[model samples]
Target chain A: MNPPILEIRHLDLQLGGFRLADFNLEVAGGECVALMGPSGCGKTTLLETICGLHRPAAGTIHLAGRDITHLPPGTRGIGLVPQDIALFPSLTVAEQLAFGPKLHRWPPGETRERVLSLAKALDLTSLLGRGLHGLSGGEARRVALGRALALRPRLLCLDEALSGLDETLHGEILAVIRDAIRREGVTALHVTHSSAEAAAIADRVVRMQARVPDAGERDLTANPPNGRWRHRSSGPPPGPEVGRC
Target chain B: MPSSPPAPSHPWRTRPELPFLLFLAAVLLGYLGLLVALVAANILTVSPAQALEVLRNPDIIHSIRLTFFTCTATAALSVLIATPIGYLLSRFRFPGRMLIDTLLDIPILLPPLVIGLSLLILFNRITPSSCCLVLGGTLALATLVGWLAVLPRSAPPAPAILTTLGLVSLTLLATAWFTRHSTASLETLAGDRFGLPMTFQPLGIVLAQLPVAAAFAIRTLRTTFDQISPRYEAVALTLGCNRGQAFTRVVLPLAGRGVLAAGTLAWARALGEFGPVLVFAGATRGRTEVLATSVFLEINIGNLPGAAAISLMMILLAVAVLLLVRLFAGNPPPSGQ
Candidate 1:
């Protein structure tokens, strides 16, 4: 198995007064981990924190064996496709896909080639010239996926990536995501509430709670001793401590 | 997109929208009738030759040019300032942000005369004596110095020397003009105690126009930026764009229609500004006169036909500007409040 490409320890965050304490997780390279939690459990907060959109109150985030707790999002080599599927309204599908490469100063020829290849892979060839607002929900979501993967990031963060799709569309997107992950072999941390979605795509699942349980309430803990994924079906452990697995 | 529910069985209750629509239409028609009557009365009262003569008057021609130039410059400066202010208000949260947002509305809400009075008081307190000369000399020196500083060090010395000579001559001419025109006004406002000539000067008109017009520009643009999802910017960032790159490449292009709308609205408002301009910059016949002021000037002189002629020009300017903006910047969808 590949080494862990993403490592989180003792993460503490308070978003709009909702506190997430001692949050810890890790994702091995090429592994797809689904983060499942109830609404308002800070699933998206963790994802945003990892990508540097929101600063953690405390804790360090290491990615690809490098400490990146204070790095800016653009330099972090991480891609995030938010739940809203926010395609730049002014850009065409092709331009949107080319955005990352262009920002990184990729040569014109190579950017074009990569855009065309991604468009084909995501079945967006005919829609490459279309404006973002004209795309359907499924189409826009797919374009967002293509955009996130355009940079070939070391870690991809998806926040409720398939939340709005119908069952068939969801399955289709799931298949496409699986194919892309298999092809790129990049680590992924996906946030969703759907257990079926987690089962469909994740190599392992991580659950977070709105409030870390008190020490006295501690029961079964999924956190193993070494900071690796451990499944627990019973009542939540008092809480997982930082680096205590 | 959903259609409204059917009204009640009673005819009056069933068609409530009809009365509302009719009431609004009547109010609109009332204003429309007033405009039509004004134009018709003016045209009938004056001969075509008399109107043409008024337009050809040196004072009238000069006023027209001054009006367009000052208003355009004010609108341009307001837009430049409003863009960043609007962006910051839309994108960031900070201590005092709410206070700043509320304060921005003060210019629009306050009477134009109040704003003008406040500016006069401010200048009086800060630089009452020799304000004109100090301001004029400082501006001239700064411009020339800035130009010289930007010249390439490795360029041929001959061109630089020639340009320096030209700049000096231009500065001297400007200084002479500022000294002659600004002195009398300063004496008038500050009375011999402190000759700070803001009243009855072109600069005074611009100063009066800036705040009121900038309020409209900022309001239009802030609403536009607020309506746009910040997610687009975040996505751009994830795509490897720095903050500046994201703003220029993604945010700016999307907000182009809004910027145009804001500029057009500010320009129109500046063109119509009279109260502030009158209070801050006295309606000096050939100097501080704009189309709006010319109307009042002609009216005060009992020249009804001349006033009508100036009012017609204002309407025409407004229509032309609105048309150009509509043609160039296609209308952005209105935000639901």
Candidate 2:
């Protein structure tokens, strides 16, 4: 049997005062997992660590049976739609969609085809020529999703990518994302605060509990093991657990 | 009948903070009035015809040309050097990072005469061969530090180690050759090799203007990068762009206005540079003289009118350039139809 598309074991990370400890997760090929937790529970930090923006304090991340714990983000074959919908302000909708393929050096014809198809899929064909400055919230979110999916990454991570949308737009975007994930045949790890959204899209929902650090863990927070800044937890660390929806 | 209600006090009179607010306004306007008065005095000191006559002088024309050339070169060089340094400072935190940042600000904070004196002393004390040796030694030290820093990281350490070793060896060999063969001051070498000596030369003017101007540019660029959300670059990285590609493709385009602002500010700073150029390049007519030194030289010759005329010209030129930059920055081209 093929190994899981992405596997994390004993993952530990600390950013500022927040920490994630002993976190473990697995997503099979073409599976979508929604990570639900309260605010400041290190959900976004987990996504960042997986995407190579931040290095893990300990543990390993495997993609397609290969250890990618130390690899750079570009070579990790992961795509991210950040919480802010970080669409490149300088790029038009078409350019945004084409960015990843161009960087990966796809031939012009194939790139154009992929862009056209993705624009059609995302309903961005009419807005392709438009810049990000004037894009509505929903439009910008679509652009961000399309840009991420354009590269056909092995793993796609979304950090609250569909939040703050009206019900109709939210449902529309959720459907678009689900279709794209199925058609593209990529695994996904989505961080969200809404259970409804998670249930509507995810194959399984994994709820995270805020883990209060014990006295022994308090020492680690005061003086971290590595050169990382001491994690001064205002409340508690998010200890993620695996559960079937 | 009930007594008529007392007339309401005027709002301005009833406000308790009115006097203090008026005082603040007075102070602000007084400062502005002083600047306006100074400019008016300079302008009224020279008749329009006299100012035009000053512009027609060959010496004055030479100074103007020299000023434009040197400041443009300085600003360009500043931007070139500042971009990478600024980016590194903005994006990374390494050991001694704070020290390096503070060191970068010395050029800006030091007295201009002190900077000039330091440069003069350095050029005089160091020969070309010795300079090469010092530079090579610095590179070797940097390579050692880089090797140590990267060794523990997950990155393939061998490639970085090998490349830096190769560069260090090459530099050491060059340094050895230079030490064995040549023993000439850098200024003399420059004069012979490029026909432009460092001391009392137009090139010296650029060197004098460079340090402070580059400091300003670095500050501007660093702030600009800080203001931009790093998530843009992070997103680019996830989309298959390596660090350099991410920076060039995402961060740079977003920093367009800030870059322009940096260059313009540096250019303006270089244009008004006086003490360093005067001390290092010397105010020689038809040679190293720039607008700032032209004003000085006119005053030295007891020509206050000519000095005021030149100062006025400088002010106008600086204003025009600033306005032009504002216009360009304010109306960025439509990103798309």
Candidate 3:
């Protein structure tokens, strides 16, 4: 059997006073895991760490059975859709979608094809030439998603990418994301507060709990724990499930 | 029927802060009125015919050309240096970061005469080797601080390179310092070997203008970089862009207006600089004289009308450049977008 697509072992991260210690997780190929946690619980931090935006204090991160702990973000084969939907303001929808492939030195023909397909899939064909300034929240979110997915990354991490949408639009974009992920066959780690969002798209929901440190703990002085795994909220445990959405 | 709330009163008449607002407006208008009066005086002192005659003077034309050339060079050089320093200040948090930031303000805060005197002393009295030693020491210290800050998170190979660079800089600094006694002053060396003496030369005018102009540019760019969110660069990195690519592709496009603003403001400031050019470059007609020094020379020779005319020209030129920048750049893009 193939090893898991993404794995973390004994991960320790310290950001200011907040920390995530002794953290462990594994995601098989083409699986989507939803991480639900309260604010200041290191959910975004964990996502950033996995994407190589932050270095771990102590741990190993393996992507497709290759050690990527010390790799730079550009070479990590990870894609991130940040909480703010950080679309490049200077770029048009088409340019934003093509950004990743262009940076990786893709041939113009293939890059154009990838951009056209992603724009079609994400319903951004009409808005491809429009700059980000005029994009609605939903449109911007789709652009961000398309930009990330354009590279066909091994792991896609979304931090609150679907917040602030009305119910109907939320459901529509959720379906779009689900379809895109399935089409690309990419592993995903999604951070969101909405359980309904988790239930609708994620194959497994993992709730993160804040773990306050004891006063005399040695690690507490160095790096206090902010959050740890509480339980699997739903879905089958550990192994990859067949036919995941 | 429910009782209606009290009807709103006239905003200007009923607002409690009206008096304070009026006072603020009065102060603002008073200052503006003073500036208007000064410009009027300069204009009224010189007729168009006299101003045209002064403008046609061969020496004055030379000053105009020299002023434009030197100020443009100063502003361009200012922006080039400020971009990297401003970005570093905005994005990183190394030891002595605050110190370095505060030190950058010294050029702007110091009296212009002092800057000129300092430059004069530096070029004329200090040996080239001693100057090199000082420059190298500062560079080595900065590199050491930066390397130490990144050591914890950087890859092993990067730290090795930084360490080696720091060591090399330090060694060069020590060697220069040991050999300082045998070296000639920078001014003498330039005059003897290169025929490019800095003091009392056209090059000295740019040197005098550079420090203050670059300081202002740095401040402008640092504020601009601060306003932009770092998340754009972070996302770019994850999308397969190295740090340099992320900065060029993501941050620079967003900072286009700020760069323009910094360059224009620096040029205007350089054009208006007077004391430093006077003290360092010596205002020789057709040689080291710039527009700012032209005004001083006109006054010294009792050409009051010529002085007024030149002053008005300077004011008009500065205003036109500023207006052009504002019209072209418009307002900065909304931060939210």
Leading candidate by TM-score:
3
User: Model 2: per-residue lDDT, tens digit, A1-245?
Assistant: 34578888888775545667777887778888888765656778788889998888798999998899989998898999988787888789999999999988999999999999999988999999998877888888888989999988899999889878888989888888888888888889989988777877787777665654565554333433322221222223233323322
Q: Taking the tens digit of each residue's C-alpha lDDT, what string does model 1 give over A1-245?
A: 67888988888765444566676677788888878766655677678878877777688999999998888888898988988877777678998899899889999999999999999999999999998666877888889999999999999898888987998989999899888888887889888888778877888777764343457754323432212222221233232212210
> By TM-score, how accurate is candidate 2?
0.86
lDDT of 3 by residue, B263-321 (tens): 99899999999888888888999999999999999999999999999999999999987
Interface RMSD of 3: 2.1
- Assess each prediction's global lDDT (C-alpha) against the native: 0.77, 0.82, 0.85
Candidate with top lDDT is 3
True contacts kept of 3: 0.77
* Residue pair clashes in candidate 1: A218-A238, A223-A245, A224-A245, B186-B197
DockQ of candidate 1 compared with the true complex: 0.32
Tell me the spans in candidate 2 whose CA falls farther than 4 Å from its real position: A1-3, A14-19, A166-168, A216-245, B1-14, B132-181, B324-337
> Runs in model 3 with CA error above 4 Å?
A1-3, A213-245, B1-10, B138-168, B171-182, B191-195, B324-330, B333-337
List the candidate 1 regions with Cα displacement exceeding 4 Å.
A212-245, B1-53, B121-125, B128-199, B319-337
Tell me candidate 3's TM-score on chain B.
0.88
Ranking by lDDT: 3, 2, 1
Provide the TM-score of chain B versus the true chain B for each model in turn: 0.69, 0.84, 0.88
Choose the strongest candidate by DockQ. Answer: 3
| Tens digits of per-residue lDDT for model 2, B71-101 | 9999999999889888888887553468779
